[model samples]
Target: MITKYKLYFLTLVVSLLLLGCASKQNFIDKSKSITKETYTYHTFENKNKLQLDFYQSINYKNTKPLILYVHGGGFSGGARDENYIKNYCSKMAKNGFAVASISYRLTMKKLGFGCNTEASLKKEAFIKASEDISYATKYLIDNKKKFNIDTTKIILVGSSAGAEAILNLAYVYENKILAKEFKYAGVIAMAGAITSIEKISTKRAIPTLLFHGTKDKLVPYNVAPHHYCKKNKKGYLQLYGSKAIANKLKELNTSYNLYTIQNGNHSWNSKPMFVYFREMISFIDHQVLQSKYQQKEVVKKISDYTSTDL
Candidate 1:
């Protein structure tokens, strides 16, 4: 015969297990309203391959705008199809947009991005990743007709290291890789920063949406060293995070939106991807597609998640 105490303990264990499952579900949207296809974008000298996973609405139509997403992994490790990213991409596809998650060279995989790593090597990783982004864009543009993509409306989206690469491509780096006239429609950076705010002149600025945590230590919320490496360290490269980038855009009279998560941390990199999906779509539609010029700043406490997030 089972004792009353044993029965109560078993019931409690079951309850906790159910709650755990529910919390996991909250992180990703599981709707199946999208279609996905994978394509090889590049082949390296060693015969290794880089690919992109494209997502679109199941009720597909032509000339849809694309959200070219780059995954965050601190330049060392990350994949194009992380679950959270797929969830976000699926949600966007359902809302009448196409999404592409691409694979790029992880140059910093061997040497971690820390105080011990050389700053120049870190910068090279950025350049190499951005170059891959450019090549991915070229592949999509070349196959625009087949993919039914509006090449002109391709917005760049990234998380963490991915964010840094896209930001660098948008502001600091010249397009010596792609067509001279080619330009990204907009930029959505999640916990991203740039090397130089000076490159964000009137001629180079674009519609940008930035999401960052005020207390982010890995990627500064304002101007600070990358990973907060000490000045005496070789990897002490200063970065201009979301706040600084938005300020630069403001100075240039450019369209930009800055979402500051108070007391949040590096985790904000992926959280905003799902939590602020509506806001992201709004920015893309109004700021990028419609070419509306609007500058706005929003701040919310981390505790706000209890009332707002899924």
Candidate 2:
């Protein structure tokens, strides 16, 4: 009952399926060399354990810089196992850095404080996330020996809401007892903002690298509401975007590098992953790894500046 054409079609289908499976397997196998381990960084009162996934390169001999990557989900729903996060972390590991993707407490549904304004609610969400980041940092520091982490070269890398949290952790909370314990080498904020520029100070300044799309609607490229709503709008808080932060750093005579994607939307990572990665690695090399902190006045617009110029 089998015609030649039917048999040929069936054979082709099977071949395609086999090829697809082989490609998938190959992809998985390629990343298998990067060892992954999970650890409980925090335990909430409800017995929920916050965990982080750390990726380490097997071939690297000496201790490596630690990069704590925070996923962005608008403060609601992202995970350490997200494909993008995993892939980014894996690439970072291969580049001779120990990378960790973390799961922090989210505040998407409701504000922690009852009967609070939109701005206050947003602030509370950021504060909660920052607290989690702090705890995760402490956990890593405590287990630095086990993870072979170079405490002197620790960097916080975050995207969107996660970026907001790390910015707060690095600047706003710097005076706090918990934050003072650790001296971070640098911070990478992708499409992130802060509630106020007052959080940034000369004494607590650290070299920062920022990547933001000019037309980002969710988080402003310049400055806008927390979710890009109008000022004083209900359920939305005003925020200072990367541009503002860079300007503040410039005013304080601190070191910072800003990358702007002209006419690009919020998903700059999708198309420019390699570009951002190269710039970030270069920043780490010069600003953090090489210990270069030239606090020159940032004259031109950040978009006009190149990585080499920084």
Off by over 4 Å in 2: 1-28, 110-117, 174-179, 269-272, 294-310
TM-score of each: 0.89, 0.81
lDDT of each: 0.85, 0.74
Indicate the worst ten consecutive residues by lDDT in candidate 1: 4-13
lDDT at position 230, candidate 2: 56
Q: Write the per-residue lDDT of candidate 1 for residues 1-310, one digit (tens) a residue.
A: 9653345334434533443443334523444556889999988899988899998865556467889999999899999887777777776675666789999999999999998999999999989999999989999999998888889899999999999999999998877779999889999999999888887888888999999999998999999999899999999999999999999898888899999999989988888877886688778767987789999999999877875473
Count steric clashes of candidate 1: 0
lDDT of 2 at 117: 43
lDDT, candidate 2, 31-67, per-residue tens: 5568889989899889999999999878665667899
lDDT of candidate 1 vs native? 0.85
